[model samples]
Every structure is written in C-alpha cells, then in structure tokens.
Target: MTKGLPMRRNTILLAIGVCAVFGAIGLFALHMSSTSVRASGLMPYQDARAIELGKTLYEEYCASCHSTNLEGEPNWRDRDDDGYLPAPPHDPSGHTWHHPDQQLFMITKYGTEKMVGDGYKSRMIGFKDSLSDTEILSALAYIKSTWPPGIIARHNKINGN
Candidate 1:
C-alpha cells in the first residue's frame, strides 16, 4: 500500500509537469502568431493610397519643421540657444531611415521626449491626440517611399523583414 501511494504521487507530478510544458508551448505559439500579425499589419509603405494620404498629412502637420521636401530644418543637428535640437530631416540625408518602422511610429505618435525619457527636451510634440495610428503609419510610409531602393531594403532588413 505504501509503494502504491508513492507511485500514484509520482504519476500525478509527472502529469502536471507535462501539462505545464504543453501550456507554455501553447502560450509561446500564440504570442509568436500575434507578433507576426501585428508586425506585418503595422506598415504599408507600398500601398499607393497610404503613401498619398501620408504625404498630405505630412504636409499639414510636419512640413513646418520637417520641410515640404522632407529636408528637415536647417542646422537640424545643432542645439538652439534654448538648448533644443531642431527637427531632423526625414529624407535619406537624415537619420530617419536608420530607425525601424515600429520605433518611427512610436516616436511620431509619442514624440522624442517620451521615447527617450529622462527629462529629454524635444521640440517635437506627440501627435497622438490629433493623428490616428493609421495616419501616423501612413505619414511614416510616405517618408519611407521616398528612400532609394537600397535604403528601403536596408530599412526593411532593420525591421526584420
């Protein structure tokens, strides 16, 4: 009877361990699927309509600082007398293409300060209150569409494409 009791306890523990392993595998699979879907859906830089809409939105909200041609502000790298860095260009001449798509979206929606944290001062303000996620993505797509093929490919690789 004592032997049987120990055997039964061991079997129960083994069963629990199997269940836990399977549960973890299932959760991991679910997470991976959702992540893939989210990543794929976030950027549609190839869609002409999205690019056009993005261009319009950029002109309306961003052109003042970023420039109509996406050339960004003059002396964009230099800090002003107030210690504020000017808006950087979105063109290939600037660093915009260096960032991943998701990061660019976040920076646009939340602004540079929020992403950098730690009392970082940026003249760029969050557009979350004014622009929808789609609009923000569109604007980013428009910026990306202007990049050369090699640059676009590099940016895509950066995003794990």
Candidate 2:
C-alpha cells in the first residue's frame, strides 16, 4: 500500500509539472499575441529607435535576399528552379506596399508558407521564433518608412486609415 501511495504521489507531481509547463506556454503565447498586431496597426515607422532597430535587423536578416537597398532579387517576379519566388523589394516600386499593415505583420511573423496555406512552399521562414514581436513590427515600419509620401498615402488607405 505504501508503494502504491508513492507511485500515486509521483504521478500527481508529474501531472502538476506538465500543467505548469502548459500554463507557462499559454501565458507566453498570450503575451506574444497581445504585443503583435494592434488594432490601430503599424506603430513603429516614424519612431526613431524603431526605425534604427529595423534598419539593423533588415541589414542582418533581410539584406542577403532582399538586397541592401531593398531592391530585392533580379527578376524578383520569377520563380527559381526550386519553385520559390525570389524575395521582393520593400521599397515604393515593389508590391510590398500593396498589402495592408496587418497582412505584412502576419507574413513576416508566420512566413509565406503558413500565410498562404496548404500546398505552398516558401523560402521565407517565419521570424516568430527568431525575432521578437517588437522587432517584427519595427522591421515592417522601416520598410514602410522608405516609401514615398503618395505611396504611403495609398497604403494608409488600404489599411483603412
């Protein structure tokens, strides 16, 4: 009976530990979601610190594929042999501005594969684990800050602002 009692106690402890792990994960996820994609959208573009941080992140994580000047790949509209589209420019000339702020956030955080859904392969891996939610927002804001005033206006309209 004592052996059975010990075994039951161990099982109870294990269950508590598992519950704690899941609870912590749930809290973290909630925090992440709250910090990202605010209802008003795109908070970092004009902020000096965010722009600077975004520039650093862009050069480090994005420049290799998107170009140092945000020019993207040569013939970016075309697909590679592996059937993935080359990275597109984030500048005014690019279609990046065509998408709304929330979409841009989702694509950056979740990557093209998950954003586009099933049967799709994407070279863009999600930055959710790699970059903080704040970093992701800053990067997007930096991209928008590069656009011309008229383009920015159009984008704002698309975002329903």
Candidate 3:
C-alpha cells in the first residue's frame, strides 16, 4: 500500500504539470491568434467612392466612441490622477488631428496595445479582427474627410507626403 501510494502521488504530480504546461501553451496560442494589423504601406484612396465607403465604416464603428460630430468626451485633456481621460473629442478641438495617419491607423487597428504598450489597457478595441485593410483605409478616409482642409494638409505634411 505504501509503494502504491507513492506511485499515485507521482502520477497526480505529472498530471498537474501536464495540465499547467497545456494551459500556458493555450494562453500563448490565444495571444498569437488575436487579429491585430501591423502598419503597412499606405494605400492611396484618391476617389470619391473610397471616401464614401470610409465614411460609412466610420459611422458604424467610430461614431459611438468618438461622438457623432467628432466631439470626443468632455474635458478629454484633463486626465484624472489615475491618468484616464473621459474619452476626449476627436474633433479639431481634441488632439486626434495632431497625430499622423499612420499613427491613427495603428491606434485603430492594433488599438491602445500598440499605442500605450505593456499593461496599459484602454477601452479602445482593435479593429484588426473586424475590419479588413481596405475597410480600415476606408474608415480612415472617413475620419480624414471630417477634418478641415487645413488640418488635412497638416496631417499630409506630417506624413511626409
């Protein structure tokens, strides 16, 4: 009975280890499977049709978080002590216009994960899984369409175009 008892304990330990290893592997796989788009060469959309599609996508996905008029949440610049803003306006009033198109694309596709890094979680969800590259471009076009001509020119300059 004593010998059998040792064998049973060893078996249980092995089973636990196996389970732990599998659990870790599963977590790694899950992380890898996440659909986060990496930055790619810009796709030019110098047409009205592309702009319209982009507008539609923005209305469907971004309008809720960014607000209908692109006015983000109120008092967005004033971050609390914990460093979370109340979702600032995406309009010219906010700093969204300040960022280049590539940065904006990354933020939208990879979300705050790429923007903040580490465990700096944000409510921003990556659109990589939901939106294709073309759709993302369209959405971006839509956002850019919202900006004034001056803001758009500034952004183009920042992008080195």
Question: TM-scores for all candidates?
Answer: 0.75, 0.76, 0.67
Arrange candidates, best lDDT first.
1, 2, 3
Question: Per-residue lDDT for 80-105 in model 1, tens only?
Answer: 89978788899999878766666677
Tens-digit lDDT string for candidate 3 (17-67): 435533443343345444453333342445578779887887899888787
Model 2 CA lDDT for position 7: 71
Off by over 4 Å in 2: 1-36
Q: For candidate 2, what is the lDDT? A: 0.75
Candidate 2 clash pair list: none
- Give the per-residue lDDT digits (tens) of candidate 2, residues 56-137: 9998888998998999988776558997768888888777887767667767787776655544666888898899879988
Q: What are the Cα lDDT values of the candidates?
A: 0.77, 0.75, 0.65
Candidate 1 lowest-lDDT run of ten = 28-37
Clashes (backbone N, CA, C under 3 Å), per candidate, total 0, 0, 3
* Model 2 worst lDDT window (10 residues): 21-30
